[model samples]
Target: MDEIYECPQCNQKITVPSEIDRAAQLELAELVHMGRRIDAIAVIIAKYKLGLLDSKIMMAHITAQKDTCVRCGNKLLEDGVTNCASCSALNLNWQ
Candidate 1:
């Protein structure tokens, strides 16, 4: 069953799939931050046993909201390397 959550700030309803738990989200974010896109995709393929195209789509969906602080989800500076304003976490745009 899908989990429904209410956004505390916006009071909007959000539906989340059970497969993509918080820990998996964090792990994918970490892999993206390290510029290991292939590894990230491989993880999805192995976990879901999906083919290449499907796995790529899953990876894209997982990381569509990139360029944010992996630790705090703060918008990152565009300089390619900067510290997150909210949590002092390092943000690097390796692409």
Candidate 2:
């Protein structure tokens, strides 16, 4: 029977044979050395799941944002406060 594992990157579950754990482990190790820490952890976690090994993978999801200040940036969210957290300037332009 094929084992299913959850991808820590995109959160999509996948299936692979238990025997491929070693190869997967090697690939994940390379990713870590490349500074792709999150991706590496995801691959290792998936491989462990397929190998029927006990493992715990913790990952935090971060949403990307532009460099502009919160108020200067687009009106992404509506808050009752009038000042911007990033620049601490009055949001007079807010409408």
Candidate 3:
């Protein structure tokens, strides 16, 4: 079932799919890093059914583990490979 959520940023009601287990964790982190905290929290809340505080905590944990592949969440090497050697995902320099 889809759940209706209020956007913490825009205050707009959003319908979130219940099945978001496959949603990229790195995507959420990127959102937070890009100053889209509300969008990232919304996804975390919907995906985990957690309250706002917990969602923020989850986002912190996800973002803290930096240097990961955005697509597969694999740990990225310090090497100068622009692309993730493991998943071929673009190694975005979030720093």
The collision pairs in model 1 are: none
Candidate 3 clash figure, as a count:
0
Whose TM-score is higher: candidate 1's or candidate 2's?
A: 1
Q: Write the per-residue lDDT of candidate 2 for residues 8-47, one digit (tens) a residue.
A: 3345444444554445534543554455766645654665
Candidates sorted on TM-score, descending: 1, 3, 2
Per-residue alpha-carbon lDDT of model 1 for 1-95, expressed as tens digits?
Answer: 64444333333343333575667667766787677889988886776455776555434433324667545677766543345667654443333
lDDT of 1 at 64: 26
How close is every model to the real structure, measured as TM-score? Answer: 0.46, 0.28, 0.41
**Best of the candidates, lDDT:** 1
TM-score of 1: 0.46
Off by over 4 Å in 2: 1-22, 50-95
Q: Relative to the true structure, how large is the alpha-carbon lDDT of every model?
A: 0.55, 0.37, 0.53
Q: Residue 75 in model 1: shift from native, Å? A: 5.2
Clashes of each: 0, 0, 0
Better of 1 and 2 by lDDT: 1
